[model samples]
Target: MRDEQDDGRGAALAELRGRLAASVAVARLNRTQLAARAGLGRTTVSEALSPNGPVPSAETVAALAGVLKLPPGELLALHRTASAPHVVGDEGTVTADGPGRAIEGYSPHDLEVHPAGPGRIASGCGGVGGAQELPGYVSRGHDRVLAGAVSDAAAGRSGIVVLVGTSSTGKTRACWEAVQPLADRGWRLWHPFDPTRAQAALEDLHRVTPRTVVWLNEAQHYLGDRAFGERIASAVHQLLVSPERGPVLVLGTLWPEYAHRYTVLPAPGSDDLHSRVRELLSGRTLPVPDAFDSQALAAAAALAENGDLLLADALTRARDDGRVTQDLAGAPELLNRYHNPRTPAAKALLEAAMDARRLGVGPHLPPAFLTDAAIDYLGQTDYDQLTDDWAETAYAELAEPVHGKQAPLRRTTPRPSRRSPAPAIAPQAESRLRLADYLEQHGRTARRHLCPPASFWHAAHTHLTHPDDLNNLAQAAESRHRLQWAHHLRHRAADLGNTAALYRQAEHRDAAGDQEGAEALLREAADLGNISALYRLAVMRERAGDRDGAAVLARRA
Candidate 1:
């Protein structure tokens, strides 16, 4: 009976492959072209049509069918027939429909959607007449363009749409609203966030099925990986161009800095660090203005008159600032909390978080770092007045929810270690806190000209783990003419394999008359393929009369 079952399965799979091969031939597409168009790996496409290959999944069959301009239903049926005998038990049985079975990620419709807000607003303005939630979204010019893009995706044209704006600007809310219709239309939404954004996308993007929405909130996390960002960009580009496997909508939101990073063209002869990212985002970004225009304010006024008390309050208060979205999101309350903490220690903590954010620390702030840095922001008299447990008290007060929504410092659960391949082990206690987005943005402009104290640098060096942050601190220290601190920071960054830091260290050594040491550092950087390091090495060799070596290094650069 087993032998007969095996024979039957083999014959079924052979028949499926035969029909698929015939379809590909009819479409005049080779295996490579078919794989690219179907968003399948080249090997996957080849195996699906191979005589000795295993039976392909229903999803793969459907993708190939779409690319070949054949009906997916028929192909899916053939795949099921070929795969049925391989099932060993009831637990192993496969289904042909339903998102849980067919799709591999979250659905936007099922998500708990909320409009842009500081946290969650329990009340509108006065405690007596407050809104339970944010006011209704007032459609803006950019929202119309975003909605049109979503509509195009619904019509079977795969594409990416990125909303670029600063924090608290309703970029996320707009995207959430744009994709809501697709959710009702049976589209699957995939948000790749597990071990890490880049890792999750790279690992599972190839298996993404048709009629799916790739939700990339805070898109910088996905496309900002120094190692894997380009690869993810390439994968997304392939997915968009793959005619058969799409009707897929890639929706993303980015802060202005990150948007500029990915979209800006490199200067002439500079290494194209964001080449693939630039290509992926080309002609796809729609800017979201920070403040509403006259037309948008008028629309908000109409909504406010229609019983949106929250919008009414924002319009009245934002008359001076024109930051209607910020008002609705409780930015004023957040600012008030920061400026008027119950204790000086709490205010100092808020200042510390703001400085850390403005000085290039990642969003996840360590409590130890905050505690150590906060003292720098306080006066000697204020610092001397603190109790032994003042840090604990300040943190608790800062973490307390305001307006029934946001806190100055929001506690966040750290993501699982990206280095670990096994299941995540929970931390013994919460280890990190996040500065509220509204506060972070406010500090960028508020503290842009201020240099952080030595205590801030020390806390950051000891607690911060990301190389980028360390490099940024080193640059700041260099600009302040604190060469010793800069050297320490650059060394720390170089230890973490930051090529830019290595190159900078080389320049510093040369400036200090350590010619041999500079050459050694430059060689290390050149070996890691740092373009600037290569050019520097060429210059050093030419100065030493090693013309042949200089020519080789210049050519390599």
Candidate 2:
């Protein structure tokens, strides 16, 4: 008996043959001429363009659009429809008729990867020796999703599951665990969600064997992008509702921000195609949770010790800023300990040390500056060395305060107390007080050797009062690959009316991947008569293919 899949596909080909003949006539060409334009042999084009029983190859269909001047996308849709066993039904639905041979363009090689364990997940990278290896998967915060998918697949229902989360969150692990139980039950796994090849890959998945699990990992570019999202959403809708398209489950993951981007509706109260998918997936959608369980907590603790991003050098070490809290879980029940200085001299010196530590680390402060800041802090607090308060009488017993500059900075991080905050935010450059003053006040050698707390520059754009010092410091930090510190000082200098600072700030921002911010700063500096900024804009315009704009900028420069 002829298979129903073959019959439905035959019907589709009959329709395609008629369309192909019409397209040829529209292009005013016979098979020979069409074959010449398409760069295929006359016989090959004849066989593919035939309106009878034989189906055309996808590549041939792809060629026809350019040869016949038909829209490429329209021909692609037709190719996708005719090549897949899931026959396109009325109104663009994929309905399965019966089992048939896999569609053309679908690579069936290596369809199954041996499972390491029952719940193991495959992360394409980041293994022990950097070799690809399956690891036991943790389905953290996705219990409901895993259960729903397992229940639905076991019941022979086909639908889409979208797992949304931020970067490095375990969306892949969760979905792998969701489909693990089905893997042993003869369901084949396929990935149809590659960002660069998303729409094209979907055509391949459409032709795969029935009872397959389609993984659309990180599919935000396809489903969330404004330009291509609607077409993808329509494709997904058909994949879900078409009964003829056998029992296949679609698994996908995306960032939450991308997910929300597609929530826009087409009209008032009417959901758009992307929104429609969310409606279809009503209860099955899963978002990665911020909360953690005991097992997750243990795993996170382990990762904290061994795992880190590429910026390993940027990481700050743990700082013990004099406050002490202890929890020795295995110790005696009544055991307790307190941390504090025992002597008056120790207390005074320790307080000053804490103040010094509060200063920034990248631009280390010299001993002279730290000594001044510390002594100033002590004086403001009325910390006298005598009788626990500094007085003229105690000066005889205690030697004159020596600077910490002689010793390398053992600590650079300081804690924020209720009374004081770090110099994370500073005031205007024209303020009466100045943070860069601390970095200044000394000759070039002292300025070069010491780092100042951010607060030193904050609450005042010392650049207004100390432009020469800031320019030197910013350049030094930039040369050391400390772009962040350099950018901070340049920002203050720019606020202090330094047009050169604006251009430098833009350059640093561009290096740090803030192109828009950099461009904005560049424009500001260009308007402020910075020739370097104008030259950079000209180079940028030339690279962006705005030749006329580049010429204009170059002329201005």
lDDT of 1 by residue, 1-557 (tens): 55666677667777778888898888888989998998777877887898876567566787888887777887777665566433232322222221222222332222322333333444433222332355688888898998888889888788899889876677777887787787666676777875577766875576566677787888888888897789889889977887646667888888889988888888999988889999899899999998888888888889989998768756765755567876565565787788788999998888888887776777788898888988888999998899999999998998887542557898887775656666775552656898876677777778888877778878878877677788888888888787778888889998887789999888889999998999899888878778999999999999999999999999999
- Candidate 2 residues lying further than 4 Å off, grouped into runs, are 2-130, 133-135, 193-195, 201-209, 225-227, 264-281, 299-415, 419-557
What range of 10 consecutive residues in model 1 has the weakest lDDT sum? 93-102
Writing each residue's lDDT as its tens digit, candidate 2 over 277-327 gives 556446656787533456654543454356521111111110122000001
Return the lDDT, model 1, position 130: 31
Please, what is the TM-score per model?
0.45, 0.42
In candidate 2, residue 89 scores what lDDT? 34
After superposition on all C-alphas, the RMSD of every candidate to the true structure, in Å, is: 25.3, 26.5
**Minimal lDDT window, size 10, model 2:** 322-331
**Predicted model with the maximum lDDT:** 1
